[model samples]
Target: MAHLLSVNAGRGRPADYTDAALTGIDKRPVAGPVAVAAPGGPTGTAGSGVAGDVIGDLRDHGGDDQAVYAYAREDLDLWQAELGRELSNGVFGENLTTSGLDVNGALIGERWRIGADLVLEVTSARIPCRTFAGWLAERGWVRRFTQVARPGAYLRVIEPGRIEAGDRVEVVLRPEHDVTVEVLFRALTTQAELLPRTLAAGEALNVLSAERIRRRLERMNGVPS
Candidate 1:
């Protein structure tokens, strides 16, 4: 049974990049009821487009689609075996941490509703970038992440609502398409054979990140990369 394992949010004071170069920001648990938006809906302070747009941009910047951040449930042992180190208490920067969710295996376009308020659409998986690499305080943390756990999905809010720790999350839709987050991640990063299918799924989501993937796939096939 899938369960909400833990919920975390950035509590570290917003980094004043101009004032000082902050190497890493710490994440802590937060009260629930996070924000969400719809297509052509109001985008929050992040200044993208809609809520999905925000998620799409984040994906471009290396964030996962639904499982934006994740922490293992079997204590720190899983992290040690997978991440090569124990997750320090309150370390993994994730908005909602869950258990029993094979988030990586979750099909793209799946939806999960939380607490009757927030509706999350599984979009894609975490693609490590410089920010994540810096977060781990290692030069090759991104490569290590890809080689190790493969992390989870990043979610776009389908409806606006408050989410809190301990809220029950129910899967609303399981994708019928073969495209999964892992497949999309590989399509975007490694030039997989299923890249065309992954791009088609991304286009169905109508996300800019997906458009980028589609373009990349086209180029890779000698149609245009």
Candidate 2:
């Protein structure tokens, strides 16, 4: 029953919420199929993996490691009840709004075959930023989100294909690692000591995230980074 509730895309819009002067966080659900591909290169060089989905902040948002973003409808519903507000698909800037999937609990390097041919690997968890906080216009949003620790997962496109709403999502592979999206998020944000534990994820960790952990661990160990 795990499937894509909706595939969303956003256009670039002027905004002071982020330092980029523009943001593509106001994503809206899109009908029909949407092309999915790996946006190769580093963060600043690559764009969104979903065609027609604009990523205005190349400095932080898009790349092979963060080619796609997925969030669970269940989590949205949880927030909806807490905040007492209606949250639509893609409201969190996720490319795929999924149903019946434990997106935040998925292990690093977990591969999902969406629809027929599109394969996406879980890379990391989204870190709330000023843009996201501004988008919600909620006070203490970043701290609140971090405390909840249900940050959605970012994905790396392993195979290019087209996907649409209502497509089935199959977990084709899951690496043997205890470092999941929630674990990784807490390691990177709130608990610095947990960074060493994330090394067990190995190559599943994204390039930038791995380097960050490595550097921090080195400093903690009194070794030169």
Candidate 3:
């Protein structure tokens, strides 16, 4: 059955990843259960856990529509193979590392019942940024990541509750739409022509997705993004 492999959180601190910058991207696994709840603020808010998971950059990283980030263990293994390195859960700054779930193929607005009470809706695909690139210490990582386009999902808390490592991940709902995480990523980064199709994702497309679509439209209209 689909389940959480681990739950990770990190404290904010200075890092060499970005010229001695303070970043909370280096997350480590937390043992046992952690509370999962709505941030109760903006759409891109973080901090829904009891262990105080840090969001270093509030302007770009977290909010209501991105309360939690999740990545698949399968995908991490694929990266490990390509990079010839050990990649662990939360390495990509994901709060939950999952197994047996098609995270990239998950439809936008897909609802997942995690553990006993937490309900989360798939909001959008994570867009690789400079911080992620720095953390990976990878050259052209953003471009390469965009090309691969299996960006893990960001989820919005629907029903607040607690969750633990090894909790069953149950797909409780899936909206009738073809805008999966991979599809959204491609539309934002490579296939601009596919932008309009993503609107069908409805509430699943958060502020970040909307901005991407807006920029695509502006480019098509010969206007600056």
Candidate 4:
């Protein structure tokens, strides 16, 4: 059974220091089986509960999905190859580290029931940001990350519940379209032309991504700048 290898959380002003400090946050045991809920549901309050909603709150602040991260079981080695020297705590800043799951391939609007308490839906991929570049101390780390691991994903809770380490995570739903996290990531960052097409496909993209695609279509059609 696929389970959460670990779970992490933190709160801080966005900046270079924040990324460095996230290294020390402690990971604890999730009670077991958490539930995910829709945005604005009782369990989805931005400041309350297990910080999933808190991340959603940050999104409200205009923070893009880059503020969060998810990593696949297989790519853990790749991350180590890139940033192993900087990872003294032996954990990445990702809020969730999962095993036996390929999150990048999960469809948007798809639901993942973690353990029994928490439910997470694949909403979007975490686009690399300058903060990540600062963490890597590389000028092009953001582009490099996009080109390399394609990372894991960003999620929103569909139900609220306690999530701790070692909880089992299973896919409750998958997207009907073939668009994957890697596809979306590539479309959004490297291949600008595909943005509209990927958006048109609209199989697994989160709300923000969908909006971005719509905007691209508008621009391509010369409706507005």
Candidate 5:
């Protein structure tokens, strides 16, 4: 059975490893329950996004589109074997580290019910950026991660409620689309040609993904974005 392994939250703080900006990437597992919900602000405050999860860079990082991020423990274990390092929960900056669930293979627009009432919809896959590369402190991390292309899924809060560690996770609803998060990662990172095919997922994609597909369409037809 799929279950929530941890509920992580962080605050904005200086990170020498990353660029000259405060980051909330060093998330730690919460001791008790934490609320999971959509943002109360237009862009979203630190606590408003998910009660305790902080968003340092709103312009590029946080918003309603990426309210929650989940990474599967199974996949983390695979990375652990490859990297020869013990990766703990929240080490990858994932909000909810899950077990047994196929986070990468999950279809976009899939609704997952956590705890009693917290519902999150799969929106997109987490993109590995400079911040992530720096936080990992690994050379060629972006390329290595992009090549591996198992980037976890980002979720949008659909129903607000409290959640905690060890909570059972259920797939409440799945859209009738075959486009999974892994497919999205491949299309966005490795294969530009697959971007146009993502239109099959329709509105399941977030604004950035939708725009990327549109630009791909334009480029294919020799039109300006």
Candidate 6:
């Protein structure tokens, strides 16, 4: 069954890999229930939606649009095999480590009911960063991850509540759009030409994604962005 395999939260720690001088990318699984709520305001001001979870880079990470990050265990296993390393739940800095779910295949604006009350809407795909590459200490990690185009889904909290490991996840709704998380990731990274089609997802796309698509379309139309 599709369920949360683990709930991970991180604390700020010094890291030379990031310009912020600190990072919360080393998320570790925790026992018991964790609070989930929307961190209102801009990304720079708002923090992670999961209580006890830290967002070290407020300038580029966290916010309502990325309140929660979910990665499937299946994908992690794939990476584990390729990298020849053990990747535990939350190793990718994901808040929720999911099992038996195709997180990358989820459509933009898809709604998932996790546990009993917490509802999260898929917003966008995670764009790998310098911190992520550094965290893994893998050469050409960013490029490799982008090429795979299996970036996990970022979500917006719709209903605030407590959640814990082993909670079942149910798909409540899916928007009528072809813009899946993987497609969105590819459009934003490797395939800029696909950006125009991503607009079909409408406002469901995160602010950063929508703006990027808009700029790309404008540039294509010979308009100065």
Which candidate comes out best when scored by TM-score? 6
- With a 3 Å backbone cut-off (N, CA, C), the pairs that clash in candidate 5 are none
Q: Write the per-residue lDDT of candidate 6 for residues 17-98, one digit (tens) a residue.
A: 9989679999999999999999996577898999999989998789999899999999999999999999999999999999
- lDDT sort, best first: 6, 2, 3, 5, 4, 1
Q: What is the lDDT of residue 69 in candidate 3?
A: 93
Error of 2 at 222 (Å): 3.2
> Model 2 misses residue 137 by how many Å?
0.6
Q: Residue-pair clashes per candidate, as listed?
A: 15, 0, 7, 19, 0, 0
Off by over 4 Å in 2: none
**After superposition, candidate 1 runs with Cα above 4 Å error:** 11-25, 32-77, 82-84, 88-90, 200-208, 223-225
User: Against the hidden true structure, what lDDT does model 4 obtain?
Assistant: 0.57
Error of 4 at 54 (Å): 6.7
TM per prediction: 0.73, 0.97, 0.93, 0.74, 0.94, 0.98
Against the true structure, candidate 1 reaches a TM-score of: 0.73
lDDT of 2 by residue, 87-174 (tens): 9999999999999999999999999999999999999999998899999998899999999999999999999999999999999998
lDDT of each: 0.56, 0.92, 0.86, 0.57, 0.83, 0.93
Off by over 4 Å in 4: 13-49, 52-69, 83-92, 200-204
Where does candidate 6 stray beyond 4 Å?
A: none
lDDT of 5 by residue, 1-225 (tens): 999999988888987766646788888899788988777443333233567777677655667777888999888898889888888988788999999899999998999999999999898888898788888887898999899988999888889989999999999998887889999889887887777667788877877677777887788899976
**Which scores higher on TM-score, 2 or 3?**
2
Predicted candidate 4 versus true structure: per-residue lDDT over 76-145, tens digit per residue: 6666676655342214446677778887777666678876667666667667654555545765777778
CA lDDT, candidate 3, residue 204: 69
Ranking 2 against 6 by TM-score, winner: 6
lDDT score at residue 92, model 5, on the 0-100 scale: 88
What is the C-alpha RMSD, rounded to one decimal, of candidate 6? 0.9
**lDDT per residue (tens digit) for residues 114-200 in model 3:** 999999999899999888998898779999888988799988889988888989999999898899989988898899888889989
